[model samples]
Target: MDVLADINEYLNPTTARWYANRGIPYRRGYLFYGPPGTGKTSLTFALAGVFGLDIHVVSLLEPTLTEEELGMLFTNLPARCIVLLEDIDTAGLIRVEAPEETTESDDKRDFNVGDLTKAFKKAKKLDEALIRPGRVDHQVPFSHASQTQIKELFERMYTDDLPTTKIVIAPDSQSDVLTPPMTPISVEFEKNGHGGEESELEDIARRFSKKVPENMFSPAEIQGFLLKRKTEPRKALEEVGEWVRGMEQVFKTA
Candidate 1:
């Protein structure tokens, strides 16, 4: 379950072929935005392992990113590299949010969506000298991926099937179904409070593929609740719901 090894397999020959065949100065962008600890950074390292490339990990959350530094970072990608910009929504050098629009009392600054778009556009148009076309890529617009997907990815990377473990109590060489070491529950249903759809999993899958969920509980958070509430699925679900409500309140207040 080496994350790097698993990523190598996931990369596959086709991916290498894609990397090899793309024209010089070609670039691919990935946006891996999500709540922390959902493996966003891990995925980048894994990809670097798979592609036999170097990983340039940058945190936009850092206070020191100036325009010149950003330009230099982009300009120095090795021929085959993965340049990771974490928390891109907070990229300070982009100047995407204007503070002048908000009064001190208002406590809400204007997000310069146009500036962000322009920064992205600039990144895309830059030549190899700025960033080798095929080498520099971005992972952005990150929303929390579905709980199921995150679990799968973790399982894939970790090679541990914790997600599929059965919940049972073991004693006297016999286990009781009502009590157990672990339980599996779908966060999708817990959060949405919906039952299985009459539509096929395929149909649901296709629809979701076309439009992924935003602001859903990530696998890590879901696992945290589950682990904390071990044998109480209902209580765990309630806690998750409450957490979401609290976050909503905080956001509203902000």
Candidate 2:
């Protein structure tokens, strides 16, 4: 969130001018690295929605793609947009398969351009080149769901009537209410609710989280279970223990 906010501020028109004065290109880059199905792409889409900006996804592996075309694409992007570079590491530059070691020439061979971009690579130990300073300024890791994430997912699934307030983050001017903020709103579940029903729901989410071991399940797996028992919080709580055990067995067998 802090990163997003900082990005938001950096993308502000005022900040762009600030960059211009200093001869620094007005752009930002982030690398979301993790195993596949860890919500890396999902988070990118969410970010696009928040800022009401179009996402320009470019695949570097396209048969006809060239460095000139890549530069043209980046040069013509809108002031506020996300440029997603696909298959950034599929090339054998990292020498994962090839026995020959990569040299300095391979590093300069790839299309190099301005920032305000994002890239997703399915990796446990990601290549450092993908996230070296100005090229990709920030790196976000997405791993299996932890205990806290599991609890949050459980609460989000069962809570159906949550209200979302539009959050406006305008660094330049107060009247800049048009552009949306980083998140639509990160509704703090505990603080947003009141009364006994909310407490009961919180208690149920806690119980469900406890039943599922920490970081053992992907969020999608847990969400699948909750989706089947949607609007039946009590039923979900009751069946979660059995579901966790079954999942454990399935994983072990696999």
Candidate 3:
């Protein structure tokens, strides 16, 4: 299914009203998990752009991110915003066994893994409470990307260009002048396979896809390779074998 399209359809005004009529929270939470560098962040940004929503990124593992601070942040968030919690698995926020008995001073002075886990769980609970429908419209958890998805992402990144153009109209002296454009702009994709320029891009995309191995590397790894060999698609193809070997060696060692 087209995830973005489905999300856009679900975010309509009527959907919100339906949730309200049923006494349900008009919020949604989505979890996207896969390998690292699989375009979770990119997808979140795309969703925000498509829906004209703002994004707020938070790291649960931050040293200063106490429960009170988290509450304040959530309470002050504007309506219709996307909250992204990155590297949630590494955030150490999952519930765990409580620590052994310790004095107040000892607790303040030092915390073991169990103690830290307990604190994080408390903060996570607070986050959960505030991430309901009315305030936070969506909560997205990013995960690894599948091989097919990664290939498609690489194709889109190499072949497609998402550009924004703004046209401003000056105010008339006799009539009421609108300073800013109020209407949302719609972007339509026009396929021009026959066009020379488009054909060249398609060729490049095909060659690039041929060089990329399915499910062997993450999006980030591919991006790094592309950045190094920006104008040399053939070179990237030639060296990808060695690159994959090196990655495998590193993984084996790890």
Candidate 4:
């Protein structure tokens, strides 16, 4: 199963149609949100495989990226490429005050109204440009692909059989619209042999102040979850269901 095929099958057909037609200049906005173990970022790259587009990944967590810096980056992206900005929930939403702060927890607090407003303005401006029609269109939201989406994602990645048609045009209207494929790259996991890929690494680094130890979760967990469900997407949904149920229980108790 190729990631693109799974994407074609599981992703909203409207997106595929948009991609195939090259209808807009705006990029498709994908929101991949989930707990630590889920493979949100991996799917971005997998789609890269299918569309033959390069991926330009950015972290909202970068220490030096000002709101303007972010806006400029989004504005200047290559005509066709995947621009990933993970941890939307926390980017400018949380901040640690300077050491001179007097009160407890001031050192670590969810951003206040002023900061959030600024960040929101920046994000809104960025999204406005990025999600516009034609520049870059086709959004694929990656989460813990409920048994179904997970199956779809994996099938896209590992499945051997899928329906595909390669249309070769000599630089026509749509040819300029399509993004080029990402170059071959490999990640070297740690010497311990307990490692994860670049997406996992990006997620862990972005989400928390510290690195996520390998055993707790990895991008592969999504695949493992799918396999454990015997590749039955509905059955695989049980994994997502269990987690949701557990959260429900904890909230109920609290």
Candidate 5:
């Protein structure tokens, strides 16, 4: 389906008003499911950008995400915003057989399925209520990016128009060890200096883009790797293949 077009139609002002006039809930819910390394998160980001909406992502697996907290989160959301609940399946919703006997030691044990199920049910009820008319207008599910799309995404990660900084090495004649610069790199290049720096960044981005394989990694995986190498873009590009191989080996062994 043309997901973007469908979302646009659903978000139209007239569509919402029509639902209200019919005494129907105006909310919409979508479910996207796929294997790991898919573009589910990326699609959500794109949707938020298109709608000019702020996104609040909640991880169901978070230990602190209690039922009351979940309700508060929905209650306090802006009139028009995207609320994302990721990894819903892992949120402890599975059915479990309750233990016949209980002891003080049971309270000290990690949360079992019974406890999780109750919490999950409460959260689910809150979700249903929040999605009714006048709240949570649209829900969209994301899937993995295509091979071509994955390549493009990796390319953009490096080539996007982001602020660039230059590192200046100090001479060793004046000191026995390297000293920190008085000014931060961001402050030093607060204003435009020249086109040369931009061109250099673009070059680096291109080099990094070439190193990423098509459909080999998910957006999240690539992002995690880049965050580790944020201080050294060139190093990220140089070592991405090695890093990917190591991750694959670990997974294999596991």
Candidate 6:
């Protein structure tokens, strides 16, 4: 959130004038590179959404694209927008001291995904020319989700729709059989829905968070597991341990 706040400040109307007054280019760039499924593309889109900018994604590695077309694409871009040049490290591009592209467009966010997941080799793998001092303004590394993030992810999934379990009684026996919530009852389901209990959800989320090691899984991975047990908060809390173990084994073997 601080990053977003800082970006907001930087994008203020006065900030561009400050840069221009100091004889600096009036553009900023961000590097959102990390392991797979760690929300690289997601965060880029979120940034664009927050700033109300359209994304102009260019893949330098696209087989059919040539240098001429790349220049043409940049030349035709809207004056105000988010330019996403993803994974420049993997594009086999070496830094050339060509004159930087200039535009009279208003303030915009530039994203360059570097794919720097390998521990400290980030500097070695990524060329200096691609992300020079003034080219990239910030390097935001998206690592695996922490414990708190994991817990929040779990709670967010069940924040809406009231929770209600049903019981069915057998014809001959008095014993009650429990059934998963029937949320597909069209009109009934809509009526039953309420913003779920926050306190109960927090408790369940804490329990679920405790079952797994911190920073071991990406946010996307944990969200994927939670989606499988969607609409069943109790089930998710109870089964997280087994799911974590299964995931661990898969990771070990991989």
Whole-model lDDT values for every prediction: 0.48, 0.67, 0.58, 0.46, 0.59, 0.71
- Clashing residue pairs, candidate 6? 162-194
Output the TM-score of candidate 1: 0.40
Give the per-residue lDDT of model 6 (tens digit) for 1-254: 36688778888989988988999977778877766688988877898899998998888788999989888997898766888887676688643333345453211211122223533233335677667778877887787777788888987887655345555677566566665554422233255464445666788889888886776677888999888878777778888888887886776555
Error of 5 at 118 (Å): 28
Q: What lDDT does model 1 reach? A: 0.48
Q: If candidate 1 were superposed on the true structure by all CA atoms, what would the RMSD be?
A: 10.6
**TM-score, every prediction:** 0.40, 0.67, 0.61, 0.36, 0.50, 0.73
RMSD of every candidate to native, in Å, equals: 10.6, 12.3, 12.8, 16.9, 13.0, 12.8
lDDT of 2 by residue, 1-254 (tens): 46669778876889989989999877898877654556777888888888888998877678798879878887898778888876666643342433245555332211222111222221223456656687877777666677788889987876645334444567666776453332211223334454465677788788888887765565788888988977567778899989987876675555
| Candidate of highest TM-score | 6
Give me the overall lDDT of model 3.
Answer: 0.58
Instruction: List the candidate numbers ranked by TM-score, top first.
Output: 6, 2, 3, 5, 1, 4
True-vs-predicted CA distance for residue 140, candidate 4, Å: 6.1
Ranking by lDDT: 6, 2, 5, 3, 1, 4
Model 5 lDDT tens row, 1-254:
67788878888999989989999866666655444556677778999999898999999899877999999988898767777788775666543445557565443312211232233343233334544545544443343333455445544554535333333355544444443442322222334343454465566666665565543455677777777755455567689778866866664554
Model 3 C-alpha lDDT per residue in residues 1-254, reported as the tens digit of each score: 46786677778889888988999966666655444676788888988998899999998788888989999998999878989877665676343344555455432312111233333343334335444456555444433334455455545544434333433355455344433422211111123223454455456556556554554556777778767865444455578768766876675555
Candidate 4 per-residue lDDT over residues 97-137, each given as its tens digit: 33433464232212221232222233233344544555434
